[model samples]
Target: MDGRLIYLMGPSGSGKDSLIQAAREPLQALGCEVVRRVITRSAESVGEDAEGVSPAEFELRREEGGFSLSWRANGLAYGIPVEIDQWLRKGRHVLVNGSRGHLPVALERYPELVPVLLTVKDEVLRERLLRRGRESPEEIEARIRRNGLFVGDGSIGDRLIHRLDNSDDLAVTVNNLLSLLKLSVKPDQI
Candidate 1:
């Protein structure tokens, strides 16, 4: 049996990095491999645990087909190394921080992937973005707007896209994700 790809996506400030960090141990215990993305940003950046590389290096790697999945968002490039294919072939469940706009392509490549949408209340999202201090007020507002549009756009449809609400506590969201994972994958695999 091939492994399932859990593609977790959400707007900025939806606490993806925090959730992944907190759930890492539990996810590993359940045989899920949380992939570390390759991003075109500085390692010193205070964000997700991505491997940062220069733009030139990123382009070189992409051109050389080192990445199985790649996309550009928020003015930066992100890549998922081709090693994920090997992990999946070995029946090891994999989780990736993915882009909503790139979901169609992902589904095209991995038809059986489990698409997960992490969502937060607009007020909560706005507050978190402000606390992170990574974007200007205008930029934050724009993100919130985009998030609203995405949520209400009917794009997810009934395509087996699971939704996790990260509105109140991180622990709750983590538990919910674990439960969803258990339900999504085969029992023996877990």
Candidate 2:
């Protein structure tokens, strides 16, 4: 069975992490795996299961071909370990939290990529970002502005882009994702 690669992309504070966390166990039961990433930021700074490395080290690994896919965003570098290829070869349906800017390169690298764009309303986004308390108000505003570019541009045309609105109940969003992945979960199960 050839595997499918689900590439997840969303603006800051769009609840991508929350949806992934909630869907992981049920996805696993359906023989799907959510891949972790390697980042140049400190593990303490990000709330994800990421392998942290220095900028120099990240460059070294990138040069050594240790990553199947890599890109820099918002002053930080991210890499998907090459082990994911092995998993795909084994017919494992793999999902990855990825950057929107890197989707073109990833699609070129993995022809089977299925891109999903998780979106939230402007008010909801502003509220969520403020609640995060990770970035300065200025930074949050910048992020909100950046998000406009992705959402406004109709550039994702003709590609298999799955868009989900996460402004309301999280369970509804998760259910939509499960349905998109063809994995069904009972209401009480998730």
Candidate 3:
């Protein structure tokens, strides 16, 4: 990342969603745009983006140039709305929680993406999955394995990275992100 993308990444159950929501104000006040993705999964499930669409609808939108980029993860399809590129082209910092496996390709679009690798202890992740109460114990374990915690191929993540251990403390993690982005700790925004 060249230093402008503000890419948020981590394994499943790593508090990525919460951290992204928490960073909204600081990001916007700093002139950063948050990308709303289109997901194939049901909005009711965990890890589904709030702005979700049916698989068929997502395909239609994609065919009509609604997405800047799209990828599949664990059988689910995800699309980054085309608006994100427009905002980034305007030189606005864009904060996005993208597909972990697609980080390198995403970075190629913008030379200035600041990649942040959010991490947590394995046990903490397991506990969080349990607390969410959507997955059985076996499913949680499988998710942990699927997430492949902290195991990068050393190609993408080895580059410029701001690693945050988000184990049990979200406030600190968000604060650190704000500091890293040179954004105000508190922001007055909608």
Per-prediction count of colliding residue pairs? 0, 0, 4
Candidate 1, number of clashes: 0
Inter-residue clash pairs, candidate 1: none
Better of 1 and 3 by lDDT: 1
In terms of TM-score, how similar is model 2 to the real structure?
0.90
Give the distance in Å from residue 162's predicted Cα in candidate 1 to where it truly belongs.
Answer: 0.7
- Per-candidate TM equals 0.95, 0.90, 0.84
Model 3 whole-model lDDT (C-alpha atoms):
0.75
The alpha-carbon lDDT assigned to residue 141 of candidate 1 equals: 96
The residue-by-residue lDDT of candidate 1 on 54-166, one tens digit each, is 99999999999999899999889999999999999999999999999899999889888999999999999999999989899999999999888666633455576788999
Alpha-carbon runs more than 4 Å astray in model 3: 1-3, 47-49, 146-158, 183-190
Residue range 1-190, candidate 3, lDDT tens digits: 2125677878778898899888888878887877777788777684644676788999999999998778888777888888877676666777888766788787777656677788888789899999888778998899788666556543454575667789967889988888877742123321
Q: Output the number of the TM-score-best candidate.
A: 1
TM-score of 1: 0.95
**In model 3, which residue pairs have backbone atoms overlapping below 3 Å?**
2-111, 3-112, 4-112, 5-113
Best by lDDT: 1
